[model samples]
Target: MSAMNKKRTESTETLKKVLRFIGRYRILLVVSIVLAAASVLLQLYVPILFGNAIDQIIAEQKVNFSQMWRWLRQVLLVVLFSGAASWIMNLINNRIAYRTVQDIRAKAIRHIQKLSLSYLDSHSTGDIISRITADADILSDGLLLGFTQLFSGIVTIIGTLVFMFSRNVVITIMVIVLTPLSFFVAKFISSHSFQMFQRQSSARGQQTALIEEMIGNQKLVQAFGYQDKASERFARINEELRESSQQAVFYSSLTNPSTRFVNNVIYAGVALAGAFLIPGGALTVGGLSVMLAYANQYMKPFNDISSVITELQNALACAARIFALLEEKPESPDPSESLSDVKGSVEIDQVSFRYTPHRPLIENFNLKAEPGRRIALVGPTGCGKTTFINLLMRFYDVNSGTISVDGKPVDQISRHSLRSSYGMVLQDTWIKNGTVRENITIGKPDASEDEIIQAAKMSHSWEFIRRLPDRLDTVITEDSLSQGQKQLLCITRVMLCLPPMLILDEATSSIDTRTEMLIQEAFDRLMQGRTSFIVAHRLSTIRNADEILVMKDGSIIEQGTHDELMKKGGFYHTLYNSQFVNTAE
Candidate 1:
């Protein structure tokens, strides 16, 4: 199919989706439609009243004052009623428009929660935010305009046609012949502008993504002297956005004026026809007045519609992006069965996985961790140590073979139940905007104040917490606390829960040496009766671990206690000595 046809098809589908959302408030929509129609019909009757009063004044000496007064009063009543109906219609339209926007935003947020980590990792945060906020607002504007203006415009056009035919069919035929010109003008302009509007929306998303990136990492940008480069990149995107927006607005702006010109021709044609017929006495002066009025009314809707076509196109483009997000495939669903008695006995048998099939990352990886065993994973970067942790937590599943906890395959258990059985503390700590108490109680919300304090004390964070002005109630944001404090808070969460299994990926990387030793002592007590997997780069930290697995190129090259590995003088011995050599230097 042609490009125009493809766009038309996509637009039709997007319109259908929009209608379905509006359908949720079908009762209110119907009321708005009825009021719009009533308003237009009442307004249409005013011209006929004026026309009748005009005929009453055929001659100054032959004027009927009482009859003209009655017609004039009726016209006043019609105008008042039309205005009232129009007001109520607009109120209902506002309600529908805002509520639909709310629903769409809520749906997008809920869908984002269900999406897989891979999908979110691949998409830009700013683009997703733009789709939810900016796009939804644009759609709200379009819906409001469509409901308030489009409905009444259509009714006004049809009502005028009926009124005009009743007065003088000959002149009505002339108006009808010229009416299509207005529609043709609107259609031609809108068709070309739609593509430009789509381009504008895309560029706007890219600009948002870049702004978000720069704002979130401003320190890095300054430290690396990337301000000039970032600004240059932004300028390029901004220029593209400006060009697309200029072209879109230029084309869409033509619709109103072009349609208005056609409407004027139609109006002039009606007047000329009416003038010729009046001399023949086939039409009265009042009849001619009514026909001219109807002619203007007939073309008014086309003008109104043409003016709003810009918003309609923009709204459709935004809706398409939101729907694309909603269409993303979520993570695989879990089974109904949940893990009931998690003993932390994890076993990986012949597990093989790769992020990209062409480049293997983890192949035939196998391990068995008995209950209460401390397994330390030491490896160079890019050796799949973190990937292995992700597999155990079921963040990413293995490509082949079974990974089981307590003899039950991880895939066979419900994700919520399986994940809750383990406590994880990673190198990158996340602190939300909340009070210290609230952030610490995330793992176990029902924990008492005493329990919260005990966990904080165990994690070596209570001393710092007590120093704050508000203690545990102090609201903290991402930037409110130092990196070490944030890591302590994250560790506090694990201490509070104390799940059967633990995964610590350089959990103390941000803390000072003294705090690290203190937290490590607490961690030792915490791991006394739990199975734990620790991924560490500092070989000295894992010296006392029950077993150390030295990894290279995604495979384990050495597995033994620190003393046994050192006795062998293999890969682990060299790695351990290298770390100590760097520390001494």
Candidate 2:
């Protein structure tokens, strides 16, 4: 197909997605429909009053004052009522549109929560936020304007035309001759507006990204003295946005004045022709008056048509983006593979994983651990220490091989359930701006106060917590925390979770040696009954583990008890000799 056809097809698909968003607001939408119809109905009566006022005096020769008063009062009443109804309809539409946007925000936020880590890694938070908030808002406003006004205006135009033709066909034909010009102008403007609006939406997203970057890295700007650089970047994006917005406005802005200009020309021409026809007894004065009124009515819908078409274009772009997001395939279907309990036992069998297809990390790796084992994975940097935890958690699927928790395949078990069974601690702690208790209970929302304190004690975090004014209820954030203290809070959260399996991926890498020792004691308490995987390069930390494995290039080359590995005269022996024994001696 040609490019134009493809564009049209894509626009239609976007409209369908937008319609689905509107489906939930059907009741309010229907009310909008009723009010629009009522507005048109009341509005349709004024022209008839003008025709009647002329017909009774000129055609029927009855100059009845009481009838004339009644007709004028009826026209005034319709005008007042139509104005009130239009105002109410606009109020309802604004409410409906605003509420629809709120729902979209809610849905997008929920979807973001469920997205996997891999997805978040591939996309920036600012971009995701723009899609939810700014993009969704554009869709709401654009659709609300396009749908409600387009519906009322088009209907009103048609009704007025029909009323005009029934009263006088000559003036109607004049309008009919001029109708093609109105549509031609509207179509031309709309087509240009479509392209301009695409640019407008693109610019809006770009502007949002720039603002987000500046906000997220304000400190970096100060640190690097990049205020001038940041200002230049922002100004460039702002100018681009302004240009695109002007183009969109220019196209839509042309439709109204151009339509009115054409109407004024047509009205003047028709009135002159009608004046000649009236002397020749071709048209009654009342019929000419009503036809002129309808001609004005006709120009309005066409004028609105131009604006609606432009808005539809913007809405189409937003709808397509939103639909594309909504249609994204969520993390692969995770089926239940583990029938029996986990029993805190795990084994990796000839497993290999690659972050990217070409960048093979772990190759043909195999390891086995007993129930309730405390295994430490030690290796130089760039080894597959962290990758192993990723596999066990199923954050990234293994390239080839099977991992099992309790002899059942990892992929076979539901990802949710598998993850739920394990407690993980990360190197960089994430402490939200909330009370200490709120952070701990985030892992287990209903964890009792005693349980929280008990877990905190196991992580050796309660010692610091007890010093706070409100203890558990005291707020702890970046504003209130030193790095080491924050790490303790994260550990406190993990301890409260107390899953059957624990994976600590450099969880204590940031803490001071003294705090590390205290944390290790707490971790030892926490690890007593569960199987734990500890990935650390520091030899002092792994000395007490039941088993120590030295990993390199994603595979385990040496594994044994600490003393046993030292006696083997292998990789583990070298790692131990280079770090621990040398430091001890």
Candidate 3:
């Protein structure tokens, strides 16, 4: 109901999510805590043994070698066992923390794969990457520190308090009275630092996105001579990041020293109280020494926990962002109806769609392509050419429409199966860092070597491939190949599949005129007897299409064969003539 209550609720939810990961590895976590407790208990016994040795020497009124030797042996054994347990606990904690974070990272990646294209289009790639890599790393580090210190710190504090109370109740009460000072200081500082840490994490994601954008478009920036402008823009973002980071670190940094200062004051009060008790015959000299030791031990956990709380706040902020991304709803559920015997007869019935609700892009659009027909979509730049293709692929669902293949509704089929039926080549090519052969065979992974080579030859890509060192096996980076070469590889990929339907969205836009002609010939062969949809800016490329649809403002203004539309001198004729006249000039 209130702001404070809302904040508390959100924090509790985030903490629960983080604890779920720990709970998944609960067995290992429990073992780690047990080992840490044993280690702290052994460590706490050493001070008592030392105090007994002091009291033995005082009672004997001389150096007692036998008692001194026994106490020395006990103390040494305790130290040895405590160190071993601490080491084992650390190893177990490391395994639990790393494995848990690894599982979380894996789940995030798999979830991203299932997300719809709309989500990807709206979010920055760099921000997503930061969440998976950098944010996950922060969480892992924080968990490791927390697991290593949390159980042991609590155990040490409790054990030390018990030892202090047994030796001197008066002094123990004094220590208890001052303990809350350190805790209050830690709590006050941490609450103020939490929001600052969250802001820093967000700013870091923004900076990462900006860096990715700049690096991805470095060539364009250089070609346009906008390096200085780009640098200035980056400088502005960097300044914001700096300010946020400084503020966050500044606030969190206060927690440790502030708590330490309070603990020091508590230690001083305990020593002063011990002096008064020793003067009264209520406390012995050895008892006072043990009390001082217990007092220091009791305050140590507070300081350790206060420092860890700062780091935990940062980790919580990162975890909250990561969980938000994971919580996004994936694509709509696939229907039970399977797509069988796809014949590539696509039908769009009264489809209406838009990226936003208020501004409609494609309204009441309809098209029908019979089996084996090649449909050409020609339109101005802003016309819904690509949007139409996106809907057909179900990359984005249409607002009001039914797209069917062979009378089967597209929505009824699984997205994977529906997309598998179509072979696509776009003007923008994506090639990973791999061998040329591997890149070409991506669409059809099981294609025989001969089939791969044949597809490459048909697409006119083999000519350049043969010239490369190792030919098809040659590894190629993104910058190693020319634009036309990349386009040919993409076309070759599509050809290897030989799917039932084809969609070429300006597939030849990047190639030279001669290369375009050769690729078009390959496409013609590839499209034979299979329905094809071609979106081309070069009007000449689609002259032989079975049907041409002239589009404007998201609606088809004219539709007919090339010669039939040319004879009518309608929108198609005007578009064709303008391109022809521009080429002539």
Quick one: best lDDT, which candidate? 1
lDDT of 1 by residue, 120-209 (tens): 888899999989988888889988998888999988988888888888888888888878888988988887877888898889999999
Going through the candidates in order, what is the number of backbone clashes in each? Answer: 0, 2, 0
- The global Cα lDDT (0 to 1) of model 2 is 0.81
Tens-place lDDT digits, model 3, residues 182-212: 8998888877676777778888888899889
Cα misplacement distance, residue 394 of candidate 3 (Å) = 0.8
Residue 552's lDDT in candidate 1: 88
Please provide TM-scores, in order, for all candidate models, with all chains considered together: 0.98, 0.89, 0.97
In candidate 1, list every pair of residues with a backbone clash.
none
- List the RMSD of every prediction in angstroms: 1.4, 3.3, 1.5
**lDDT for predicted candidate 3 compared with the true structure:** 0.89
Off by over 4 Å in 1: none
User: Tens-digit lDDT track for model 2 on 205-297?
Assistant: 777877788886888889999999989988997898899889888778888788778878877877787788878777778767877777778
Give the 10-residue window scoring lowest on summed lDDT in candidate 3: 3-12
- How much lDDT does each candidate structure score? 0.91, 0.81, 0.89
